[model samples]
Target chain A: MFDDRSPIYRQIADQIKDDVLRGVLAADEQVMSTNQYAAYYRINPATAAKAFQQLVDEGVIYKRRGVGMFVTAGAQARLRDGRRERFFAEVLEPMAAEARALGIAAADIVARIHQLIPGDSR
Target chain B: MITTSALQVRFGDTTALHPLDLDLPGERIYGLLGRNGAGKTTLLSVLAGFRKPSAGAVLFDGAPVFENVRSTSRICLIRDDGMVGDGTDNLRDVLDMAAMLRPAFDSGYAAELLDRFGLTRKQRLGALSRGQRSAFAIVVGLASRAPLTMFDEAHLGMDAANRQLFHDELLRDYLAHPRTFVLSTHLIEEQSPLFEQVLILHEGRLLLQSDLDELRERGVSVTGPAQVVDDFVYGLKVLSERTLGPTKQVTVFGGLDDERRALAGRYALELGPVAVQDLFIHLTGGVP
Candidate 1:
């Protein structure tokens, strides 16, 4: 659900990114044209274009001169890198802080991490 | 933030709204769009507290807004119809009254707008041209500086040049001090650029709410041989099409990949951007 609290373009960009992650949109695949998206969703075309432009700027999508936009060749990899860069603040830091707050020993946490690894039954 | 829930309004037998729900945030510009009699004016009036909803309520930051001084004073609705006064009053008196009542009013801006529109303060309301009256209302709108500003087709009487001036000034001022602005108009192509978000009403019902950019990318126009165009558009959501002799023009919605583009190009097909107005017509046209 979209709340009016944030700019709609940012939400649209986030949704497109989610679509990429889910493989609903594939690399080298064409993305929707701004006007189509606008009519489909009944939004202003400029806001829709802003979302696509954001994706293009981040190398997640690219435009062909006379043709429409396509998902970049390494869009998934680029998105992975972007996500990895934010992992600490977005995931690890909060988990670590919570673990520390629970008074779980560092050794125990390390052992748990090791046990959770695949093919590490021993 | 402004929130409306199950908001229904009726003007005698004409139902203006149909139990609609919407949430409008502060510090941004919104284009409220619809055809004539699409309830745009009625909706805006409810939001600005000019007219109360027959059923349902409007809340500004979790509080009722109708006749509520604290919230009402922060808003100004510049309607297409000139602002009404208690009784007969000259244009000069109305401006003076606005200066006295609206705490945020900018007299300098008001003067400048009047000068730009070739309007003199001494003219009586009954004596001004329709275009001149519209200009005066717009001047009040821009100068009011209300946090939540609503302009409901305020430039209907303006010529192209003056309309452009109003748009430019609106953007310049909005960029300098961001606020919640709701502009309801039918001229989508002419004023689409200034809209950060768009809310569309269809037959007094909420049809769509979306960003302008996304709407642009969701559709493409393809023109080529009828066979090739038909083949290319196959399985896509074709909004509209026209064919003449061997050529066919197809406007379709959905994402089209480079492979498809290449395939179409191989058949000598031409692909291009669809204008906002055309796209809107295709999407909101009578045919489902």
Candidate 2:
């Protein structure tokens, strides 16, 4: 189910981060063993193991020796912090640039955002 | 682990493999990619000791492989034609033979796998359909648990659903019992995910070998306005290209550096992942 453009392990790691960020994987929650993930995704167990290793290396998840891995206590916050750090350069700036190229004013974009979120303006 | 030194194979006047040195470390899955006549089968045959090399040595753990029971017993090569069994042999007898031949063979697992593939022990090998024979081949290959197991396209006659089951079982069994697996397949995209490392052969020479991701990074796709794409890819090795109206996409062989990537970003050009299958097609003289 993974593309060959990038390594499948990297994709799996990104998905794990996404799950944590979306609260689908709570802090301290036990995660699927590498075999389970591999079987579910139909990927090589080594690839699945590599993803788990990366997460463990990053302190995004921790292992329990004989038991399975569990999400780090503050992984969601840390993941959100990482995304927030990239929000401007990765997300908002691109949106702003695209809006500018489309001839939409900054104020107009702000108004649209407000309309969608309805008073979340800061 | 298996190693080959100055190994060469010939068929009458045709040279199937050139003098080459190679190593296959144990306990990992490897994908072998090549077009037809790429010497894939020849290479696998030599590894399995089915054919003696015309020149040089094939060794397992430093000992010779040809007629060396120590090495051959630990190596199993299941060819596409299900060469592991005689056509007249009953399914049960075939598995029994395997268990007797291969030291690590597990008959119970073979039975379980046969059931999964919907094959019965009473069927004669000659009476089953092509797909069924392939499924039986897979059963022997996996159940053998050879330290070095090679499946030369295990899904040859199976349908898509059966292929999926094969991949699933391969990975699951690999986790439970790790071993070295070399899978020579033309279905690159469908099967490459199961590979940690990939070996590509062209003609009789080793073209490339690397981690699958690193190999993938060797190629990239650049897409943008036709003019922008042309300008951005001026000096790069373009493998293929397509243009539709104002937009264009060019497949570049070598990857772009960070500076070029940032430059593409400035030009609003999109950098996409080139599928390994596409890379293989272009690398092997596309469409020829």
Candidate 3:
């Protein structure tokens, strides 16, 4: 089931992106048809179709004539790169701001990060 | 497409539905929400050709549907009162009648639904429980496969589990065979998510009709420090407000654009989606 934090279509798109990034849905693999997805999720068909259309627009999926949608070639790589670019702004910035509010220094946060991942410096 | 032109239905001295125009294009699901006596059923009855509007016309594809056999055959309306047939008739008898009448009736699908709902064809309608009768009505509605199918609180007597089954089956069938569906119900919270569009009625008048997503975007709750929340909601239509110590939650009726949302984010305000049921109650001034 979906939550109210965002639009359902956006959630659907994000879920598909997550699947692709995790290799659960490999590139060139056919995704469920919009109607199938809608029935499975118990959501409006139009809403599910909108999510598919968004994926299509973002080059994550493509339609073959008279056939269903399939993951675009290199979609996972493109998604990972996009997520990497957003990591600092979307994840780290908020964490850092919260740390500052709690009187935690940036160096201490970095030390904790190093402790969590002993081999990674970046 | 189904369109109504200034449609109004009056019985004796009381007006059931006020003059209003409505357009329902084919191949979509619509949720009709209204308080009791808000004309939801009246509007649906007019659309289904069960009653002729006193002042206006109900048209299907530009032809009047009142008493038109061809048009009525393509439209099906199932109400909560078990309007399909006599109470003594068996389930199999009803299905037989449906197959003879409905041009697109799917007997195999009906049989499947009957089994899924745990309804035996040998059971008499009169002897069945309230929930069983509702399940039978829903089965007929689904298997009828009419171009325009309307269910006016047809699942009222059903238990929660059976109701969920009915919703699942309805969606699956609809996806398999695309058609137009209008569902009028008081259980908006559970079923509103299935609707592509929503029609809200108040006091025999159409309150609003909009895409479900757009309507959801119209109302949002913003929570933060009292002053910041006040400033953010200033000059907006505030539907409800709550305060606890230094924090305040204000529900506003308007779209929040990116700039305003960013502003909320900067202020550390929590913005949450407003439930469609809450919006309906606030809009209609009805008690929850």
Docking class of 2: medium
Each model's lDDT: 0.79, 0.90, 0.90
Interface RMSD, prediction 3: 1.8
Residue B186 shift from truth in candidate 2, angstroms: 1.1
Q: Note the B-chain TM-score for every model.
A: 0.90, 0.95, 0.94
TM-score: model 2 vs. ground truth = 0.94
Best by DockQ: 2
lDDT assessment of candidate 1? 0.79
Off by over 4 Å in 2: A101-108, A119-121, B225-231
Number of backbone-clashing residue pairs for each candidate, in the order shown? 30, 0, 0
* Model 1 RMSD in angstroms: 17.9
Every candidate's DockQ is 0.06, 0.72, 0.57
Residue A18's lDDT in candidate 1: 82
lDDT of 3 by residue, B31-65 (tens): 99999889998889999998978998899988889
Q: How do the predictions measure up, each by TM-score?
A: 0.68, 0.94, 0.94
